[model samples]
Target: MFVTRSVSDLVADSEGEGEKLRRSIGPVALTALGVGAIIGTGIFVVIGEGAKLAGPSLFIAFIIAAVTCAFSALSYAELASSVPVSGSAYTFSYATLGELVAFIIGWDLILEYGVSVAAVAVGWGGNVNEFLKATFGFVLPDAISKSPSEGGVFNIPAVFIVLLISVLLTLGTRESARLNAIMVVIKILILLFFIVVAFTSFHSGNFEPFAPEGFGGIASAAGVIFFAYIGFDAVTTASEESKNPSRDLPIAIIGSLVISTVLYVLVAVAAVGVAPVDTLSGSDAPLAAALNEGAGIPWAGGLLAAGALIAITSVVLVIMYGQTRIFFAMCRDGLLPRRLAKVHPRYGTPARLTLGFGVLIAILAALVPLDEIVKLVNIGTLFAFVLVNVGVIVLRRTRPDMPRPFRVPGVPVIPIIGILLCGYLIAQLPWETWLRFVVWLVIGLIIYFGYSIRHSRVRLGEKADAPSVEKA
Candidate 1:
């Protein structure tokens, strides 16, 4: 359980590099990538459901969730600065925890990123159909626009969008980051528009019984809202591609979380102020509904559909990119075929891995019924959070003098709080989700012992403190 990879080898891999991942992303682009992953379905849709549980105090729930995320974010920033692995929590686990735990977290991340991309793509297809119908009086047939579970033959739009984003990724990381930044700005503007429209009918009466359901409800709502913050850590997965990783990675990770949390709180305040909690919870399109109900704006629904289309698309792009990078790191660690991690000579990206996962995710989106499966995405992410917080404490004791560009203040204390908070959220998941998670971990153990353990670079006499020579 404690076959840890030496930190020296981890750092040495990126030093004196020849043919390797390039550092093309700056701090601003990296922060945009984090924002793109964060402000999607949570703000646009999940806020309504959270309102159901927390009543008018849904704003408080957003705060609770954001605080929980902040602790984890600090831990992530610390590990990301000092460890500097593109595998994110998975690599962090290896450096401090062990290879077996790393494999478990790696497997968990695969489920989180892959399923999230598919789920978000499916959502994008729905919102785009609504946008097209509202704007052009045309909608794709159900057969091509939805999964079979939603009564469609094959979701053509979902598959098409995934492939399109995949192509953008294959072109280069910098190109994809540029497009993501533009989409992030547009979506933030659209959300700001909603805030403006919602305030036009702000009523003090909406605050009469803000905590109608009390602290119990607020905590429950926080659990539901926790999933929305999963994508911020996706920023750390781009460490290898960052121009100045130690500085930029932490800023992107924490800055995105802080920016996203403020937006989340402001939007929640605006939403609850515009409508009663019951009314907010009743609608599938709560943000748009609030605008129309509050200010009598008939076109608000179309505007929001447009926002959802862009917002969810950026989420898919960023999460899918994170998944592929983690795969690249794992392959490089010898958990999988090293050739699969090859950087494209022209694009300087992991084109092959990115394209392959894109196609697989597209198929999953088109064919799979992911309603229940999507629940696993949240649990998987929370599990990684638990491991990351744990890794921070473990590494500090193990490597007291490691150079850290960014450090989590009050060592052990902050990380312990992070672990406890993450555990509280994980407990909120259903017993069925736990059962499924265990089954998934069981499968991961099988793969690790059967294959990964033997092939791991650290286990293959590659654990020397000195850096290995890079091949051109």
Candidate 2:
């Protein structure tokens, strides 16, 4: 029989664990972490891809995606505030939905966080190579620096960065959070600089025929631009580390979404203004290309590339961090191997899981051309968002007496909108992406039936009574 975990028991497990994650992040740092994760390749690269699909109306797409994310963010805020645990949507699903649903979301998060880190790592490798070639006239050989699909042996730079970030994460979460904050500032400043310089070359004529392909184009672009807002959920993953989770988690989650939306809209406007959509679509380094070739600012291109390197670095760090935490949560619940739940004795972070994810992601980054897989990442995230919004409604009806520090306003209405919007965005993805999502879900089901269902701690009577309370 399927049973839902209770919120109280979930909280109890976190506190009862022998080694606990240290609470070291405050609102300011947590907000910065959200910005760091959200502002990476989406702004630097996906903006151009989005522009390619929607032309100047990419601005409208940005608004659509942002609004959708805002609704979902409200759902996340309420759950994180009430639970304040480490599993993100996975834990929330476990509390409100059944173990099967929670396990599905947890498996889906692997695609969201793991593939995202690999995709961003590939972007980082390219930016670093660009910085080297432009600044010092040094380029690593194509054989070692390019993915196999791109006609190279392996992407050494991507592998190297993933491994390096893993070591940093292993060192300690607090130390990594500090470094992430600094990098976030540098990334934001560089983007602001791009907006300033690009504005100087803005032409009114560029606004002509804005919706070249009409609303269809806008919706398509919204689907692509959804990738930019992917990192806001990373904030909820840090609930265990937040000094004041009930208050800070909501602020960090919503605050980061608002800040990233404004920046993305501004950047999209500046990009379209300074360069023709066709030109932006053709280039890999869209932002840098706009500043250098389109706006006639040669030096700013190099700086933008350097900033992109830092931006992608911070993204890989946070996404990988989220991945480990999700795995840590699953391991703790006996949905996966318990050994992965071991925290570092000294650092107090999930060292084993962190290292495990890093190695797997490094291998993925080193060999795969992640362009196709990035869409898969988006689909997985949207799926989780859909489940989370539903979980909000389920929890509200089932646990009306539960203490919620930050309640999602409008309750059923807001969550319903969130669900419909997320479903729409998921439908916007390619049919191929849906196929891939189904295949991955099937694999997850096999693993769950084969391993997780039998070994679940609740099934073993460790926490059997906990689920019955909710069942009653």
Candidate 3:
């Protein structure tokens, strides 16, 4: 019988990146990285839309979504401790599920990280324009401000930011992490500001008919709005670089989830309390607009705009970082060109992949009407979550003797629930999104069978069963 490489083998691949680089990340900074990735434009932009669809029960949607995420987070914590590599679910799946599943996940993550960077870039432009107009009374012409898919000439700023972040990422991971930490601080403070001001003027009446759209709507809203939770997985991508992979990796992954869920719920409650669900859902700048209307303060919009700009920029950086790392992992596995996996001599980062991903994301951000393709991000992520949770169960049975520094409580139950919840969430997504995901997976199948399967490092006997070793 043919056997797939175990998670331990995959983690051992980090030896290529070396031990010095691997120990640069500490637990607090790792948690901050997780939070930086997790909290962003989603809270500022998507929550209102969820509220509109789910009514005041959008709060319930947040809870439901968080619970679903927690199941996966628990699974992820266990795996991150076990594998401790940079590819996130893709690397984990490859070790436990086989090359076919790994290829699909690697392809799926292209949607989660690459596509999301573009969406966030487009969103970043909107916030920047708003900040400019509010602070200095100037706005970009529609020709320059809107994405090509949105009936505009080009979103130059969006493309520019993607390129800039790409360059920054290629320069060094440490530098990028430091910048992201600062931006995360500013963005979190802004959110705290909203909570303080909005709650002072909260209205109980706004919650009337809490589930106006009913259970179906709430579930569907959870599907559509799930992208808000996409970035936390980036935390797991840093496992290889973590100072204490076993102890800190789990804290960073699960701790970020706890922090982000609380922040998301608070932000949603604050936004819904100040405005009607319908109005909040329709506004382009929901948080800023809601703050402006509720507080009757003229500068509220400007402040929120400033915050959103910082929030989305941090998101762009983190996602871009994740994209480069995932691509690097695939290339190192011989699933792609080895040149793409080379670390920058000066920066100790994946320069080629970083620059390549940046350019690709910029073009997509500049040309593609990503609003339509956005839901695929959530679908891809949910699929990854399912695999991760299931991987937890598989590893438990296959390697019962393998050390697990952070074991998820109620193993089989948590993993099973995680799989079911992810499936339910995916089912709630529009049929078109599923079709698009299938199409992407088919393309991945062709690529894998045509080249990757034969070229894989495991197939070449370089390290076969013990290619890479993960720390627990």
Q: Against the true structure, what is each candidate's TM-score?
A: 0.96, 0.94, 0.93
lDDT of 1 at 320: 94
Q: 1-472, model 2: which lDDT tens digit per residue?
A: 3588878878777766443677888998899889988998888888888887898888889999899899999999999999999989999989888899999989988877888888888888888889998787798888988899998999999999999999999889889999999999999999999899889999767777889899989988888788788898988889888999999999999999999999999998999898888768888889888887778877776798899899999999998988888888888888998767777767878887788888999999999778787655377788889988998999899989999999999989999999998887776677888787788899999999999998898778685223211111
Better of 1 and 3 by lDDT: 1
lDDT of 1 by residue, 87-114 (tens): 8988899898888888888887887789
Report every candidate's CA lDDT. 0.86, 0.86, 0.80
Worst 10 residues of 3 by lDDT: 463-472
Once superposed on the true structure, which residue ranges of model 1 sit more than 4 Å away at CA? Answer: 16-19, 462-472
Give candidate 2's error at residue 384 in angstroms.
0.7
Clashes of each: 0, 0, 5
Candidate 3 error regions (>4 Å)? 1-3, 16-22, 213-220, 375-377, 464-472
Tell me the lDDT of candidate 2: 0.86
Error of 2 at 11 (Å): 0.9
